[model samples]
Target chain A: MKIDKSLLTGSTTMLILKLLEQSDMYGYQMIEELEKRSQNVFTLKAGTLYPILHTLEQEGRIESYTKEIPSKRPRKYYMITKNGRKLLDEKKAEWQFYATAVNQVLGGEGYVGV
Target chain B: MSECNLLVKEFLNITCEEIKAKRVHKQIVNELSDHIEEQTQYYIKQGFDELTATKKALEQMGNPTIVGKELNKAHQPKTEWSIIVLTFTLVIIGGFIQYFVSRANSYNSHAFFRFLIYAPIGLIAFFCAYFFDYTIIKIYSKLLYSALFISTIIGFVFINRINGTYLYVYYSAILFIPIFAGIVYSLREKGYFGIILCGILYGGVAILCLFSVRTIAFLLLSISCLAILTFAINKGYFKCNKRIGLSIIYTPIFLILILSVYYILSAGHRRERFATMFNPENDPMGAGYLSLLIRELVGNSQPFGLSQLKGSLANMKAELILPAYNTDFILTFVFARFGYIFGVIIIALFIVFLARIFTSVLKQKNKFGVLISFSACLAITIQFALYTLSNLGIIATFSVTLPFISYGGLGFITNMLLIGIVLSVYRNSNIIMESL
Candidate 1:
């Protein structure tokens, strides 16, 4: 329930990369899908989302293009690059270790069984 | 149906390319058309109208700029370089004026010495203004104020040591200090308090130190009037019609009070000077002498002017009329030799020069531009007015010169620096416009 916003920045990038690994998506669709898949637990404002997208594009971790959709407005779609995939893999392993460590501490019943 | 399609087409045409305009257009058209058709069918099934539902659907789409913002997001950003260049150019002109005039007026010194003293100071002031981020200046407004305060104190203290009663002290402290403070305050991000304080401090010093109650009274009155105007603007008191009427009434009454005081404190010789102002026959051998001589020079001239340095009135040895002809009454001397037409031309040029500064200020967008433009304009204008009044024998003779045209080193340098600030404001205006 408690989340450090600064820590969430890296997590956000990891989430973006993993989502792009599945399929190319624009900013609005990515935000909508993230909220839906997480059961509405996560949401990103446009200001934060656009700046991250720009940073990722500048770093060549992702590429974007204008995509036209039938019966809907066209969107700026971003896809993960090879570098982004490698980065996502590294981040996933790190998150797994961090989650296990946190779970172990919370699950402890006694202090060294003294 | 045709009218609806035409509206959709016009909406699509107005949309920018940035926001996937064509795609959004297609989607809106399809969704709206489908909804309208469905609603119309539902209404028909209920035994109602078809056109009403379609009209209702179209009405809900709202204003276009809301949609246009989406398209604008993709547009490339560009910086306004013209404004930056213009601001930079004006600041440089100010520096050059200071340097060139100082060099021209330096007496018994080599040109190299003049350049050595003036060049580096001028360049540093110009470049600092050009390269320094204006935002940074704004953020550190307090530091700028303290620095200006210190410089004013220094200038005020040292001014008394310089030669010439009217030339060194009043010109430096009275005119220059407040103007410099205005420029500095304008450049910084702070409100007008620093400039207002500067004006008060300078005016205060002139009152306390100058030993002339008449001069002090007038200077204080001027500062107070300007301060009140500035305060009214800041407080938004000018918004009310009643406040405007009050200000109109208050100003002339204050001016009359200052004039009455000036007359009361004026010495016998000073009174004689005023008498001569109205009638040249009051005492031609004494107080009326300068006025009568000036009248002769102005009245005798043709269109172009008398030959340079050739008037009988100016050449004291040739006429045996007045003593100390070259210095305190220099304008009269210049007019006598050069003629009234030439005097008129010089005054016109000064007016044109000040007008140019006013024009530049009017064109500027920021508060800094407004304050600096007005302060510099007032400073130059007042000094020129004083010089003209003294020359025409309308006021007690004082030795202030017409800026740039006059032959004084310190006054000339100070004038150049003032011009530089005007240029700085002009340049700033250009930059702001370009950014827009």
Candidate 2:
């Protein structure tokens, strides 16, 4: 099933937090990682990804700094805070609960049981 | 390759049209451009030609406007409405404090009405400052500072003079020393020249104050501005060493020492206030009289006692215990009439107001905005602290207003104007902070 834009909107920060909860990453990295890991199911525009990252940075759930590497210009990297970890854990449970409920509703109970 | 660069520029430029604070939008532009270039390079490594790689990169990033709008949502200049609301609320409270005190003394109620009349004017000043693009101040900060400084001198030299020597003006006028300092520093950039220029503007004003409006309150204010300049320089205002900045930053401190020494040796009304401050009881029937009155009223009032307001009111009306009950000593008026509970509330509000200005300064990426907002905050903080100290008999009663709450046209109006500047800075604080 195709995911709704509204659903994507709601989960954008949670997904970013979840990604950052594992490793520090830059904007393009996060975009590529999310798309790759989600089996090409997620394809967020840079425009969509960055504002969420910036907002999360301001919310103190994530913070950013630039690091220099050999043979490249410095790039901005983001890391999740403890608060972001807490939020990610909560979002994980919420998604689990939500998906299970949807499965139950869409499963055998919805057709003629009522 | 050059054509490819143009495409990236066009893309990034379109991304920042909605964002104000050019520097902030520039950072976003450059940052996003970095990502685009990286992606284009990735495409090139995948066997695409340069032109195709660039085209593909642009296509993948999506429309610049949509991305720009999304980014703009986070970077929009924010106004501190909580501070604005708190300021208006306190101004109303001040009006009530004045109204009730007037009524308490003479059984007349128009002072509050007068304040009500004044409220709209103050609110207009506040909003005008809030909405006025603060960046415009940079273009004419020199002219603005000179005008304020020259006008002060002209006001002192030609407009008002007591006994052709002792300097005095409306209490509100004195508050401008610190504000003018803010304006002075707002025009500064990162260098020794800016520091020297600040010293000139501040020193000229300080000297002008010395020969004319010789108020100790302003001396403290000038010193506070120096402290603000020091802070601005430390926080990337100048390229000077942070430790060395402290030593060189004594421009105001040095001015204060010279002026104090001059004031002491010159022998006039200035000497008496210092002597009186350190020892309030030295001359109970003379210079220390008002300070002593504030002390007894505040020191003796019941904490959280409503009845005490009436008692102070009756005492004020029945006997000439404290004069200027409506103006310089308005804090005492509120404390005496409304008791300590209301008094603490007023102090808390002032602290909150200054905090609002301070927080706004911290968020600013524009150096001018940060310095300007910071100086305004420091000046007002000093005024509020000194007023409270004087009211509690902890410091010399310099007769400064309690900012928006004080009963006077110029001080009240000027206070509103500074708040407007703070609001304007807050409104335009989204300067791209790549370095800061």
Candidate 3:
């Protein structure tokens, strides 16, 4: 299914934070991994991924470090902080609540007895 | 193994062109270039030729202008509005205080008007310092330090004192302290030798002030400079043993403090002033006069409205007036004329102002920015503390002007310049790299 870009915009931060929550990652790695996990349904552009990562780092939610491997160009890696983890959990809860509410309104299987 | 292709280079250029902080352009370009290369490799392995794969990779990266605009938004220089607002509020309040001072002293009748003139000039100075990059101090630290040193010697040879106080030299010392932070930063790579070099620079200030016979300036300059050096050492910027660095930094301060105590004890007049500082009532007619007057004024002060003077204070009020009421003693004047509440509010305002400046210091990512902002903070903080103490008669009276509140042109302009440099440091905080 092709998701509208606008639909994914608001969730990009949460998705990026979710990826970092798994392990430290570089920009390309995060994009490739996100796409692979989504079965290639979500191909995050490099332009979109970096700005979110840089903004998160600025807010102290995550931090970046340069790791130089032998005979390879040094890569800038970002890891989630305690604050980033907390944010991710809240984002997860919020996303779940939001998805459940939308499904209920649409009269889907997510409907519950209120 | 190969050079970057022209198409990739052109795309990188367009992306980085949108980033206002040129300092971070290289890093961002490198990161983005790496992304494109990785994407290209993936495509090449999937059965595409190199040029076609690179083009495909670029297509996936999205438009350069949009990416660059977003990155620029992230790296934009942070202007600290809170500090700016607090500073101007204090400056306007200072204008009111100067007006009160003008009403009390005939010789200072023009003081308020002078401040009115200096205000716009101060604003210009503030913006000039704010917009200008302060890292240039790192490039010319040695030359600037030597220039200040030589100028101080020359100042001693010509204009030494105004009304028997070393005001000119003292204000110059206040201006030099912030610049000294840059010198300390420039020497960070020298290790222990850097500590020694800083010590020598500080020693030179002490010796210059000693020979020039300006003890107060020497005290203010040496103490504030030492604080910056100690801060740098503790932050491990000196790249030397912390304990050894601290010991090296403090040994001279300790020796100087002891020498000052001895010097004061050996002089009868200085000893009398020092002794009367403890008990102003003992010498109410002489050395304790100002202290006693300050205490009487503060003691009679009401909370909300103006306090009515009584007893000795009332009698003295009719016959004698406070000297420097417009300059150093403005805080006491505020308490005497307005209320303790007014004085407390002013002090609280200063506390907020200092807090704002300190917050900027914490936000700084670059070492040079940290040191510059911190040194400015230290200088202003010392002045504010000493001026308040002196005004309240808790310490012997000296010629220290309260930062942004005192009635002096040079002190006002110098303080604005310092705050400007701090704001400038904050403006470039995110853009500058951490390494240099």
Mark the regions of model 3 whose C-alpha exceeds 4 Å error after superposition: A1-7, A68-74, A102-114, B1-4, B162-165, B255-273, B304-307, B310-320, B433-436
lDDT of 2 by residue, B276-364 (tens): 87788978878787777777778667665432323534445212466666667777766765677888888888888787778877766
User: Pairing residues by index, what is the TM-score of model 2?
Assistant: 0.75
Per-candidate Cα RMSD to the true structure, in Å, reads 23.7, 6.0, 3.1
lDDT for each of the candidates? 0.52, 0.71, 0.84
Instruction: Tell me how candidate 1 scores on lDDT.
Output: 0.52
Candidate DockQ values, in order, are: 0.01, 0.41, 0.58
DockQ of 2: 0.41
Tell me the lDDT of candidate 3. 0.84
Per-candidate TM-score against the hidden true structure: 0.46, 0.75, 0.89
| Candidate order by decreasing DockQ | 3, 2, 1
All candidates in order of lDDT, best leading: 3, 2, 1
Across A21-76, the per-residue lDDT of candidate 1 in tens digits comes to 99998665676688788776666443355446655654457776656768745545
lDDT score, candidate 3, position B149: 82
The candidate maximizing TM-score is: 3
Worst 10 residues of 3 chain B by lDDT: B311-320
| Of candidates 3 and 1, the better by DockQ | 3
